[model samples]
Target: MEVDVKLFGDLREGRFEQEKTQLEENSRVIDVIKKCNLPLEHVAVCFVNNCQAEFGQVLEDGDRIAFSPPVGGM
Candidate 1:
């Protein structure tokens, strides 16, 4: 499966702000985070298809996810 990922704040450092990423079947939101090598502690807000989502939320193919940090931090 594949999903679109958008990273905000320092989460983009050493990474990309947006990209289409490949994933295994039944992957959750947190799986995408780990695949991006992101720091979970830095994620202040997360949305899936524009709705607030949790780390354990299951992702569907072609889902769009945006992750943001707290204002100035990541």
Candidate 2:
């Protein structure tokens, strides 16, 4: 199975801003995060195919996944 992944903010450091990745059947959103070596605590939002999704959300082949890291500004 393959999915499109988008990383936002600091999450893109040393990683592709957007890319496709292969995964096993029944992979969840968290799996993708781990595969990207992103800290779970830093992830503030997740979207699948432009819809809000939870970490436990099951991923499907060709699904579009976007991740946003926590943001802060003064």
TM-score of each: 0.92, 0.94
Best by lDDT: 2
TM-score for candidate 2, residues paired by index: 0.94
Tens digits of per-residue lDDT for model 2 on 10-65? 99989889999999999999999999999999899999999999999999999999
The count of backbone overlaps in candidate 1 is 0
Query: Which residue window of length 10 is worst by lDDT in model 2?
Result: 65-74
Candidate 2: where is the Cα deviation over 4 Å? Answer: none
| Model 2: pairs clashing at backbone N, Cα or C within 3 Å | none
lDDT of 1: 0.92
Cα deviation at 16, candidate 1, in Å, is 0.5
Residue 9 alpha-carbon offset, candidate 1, angstroms: 1.4
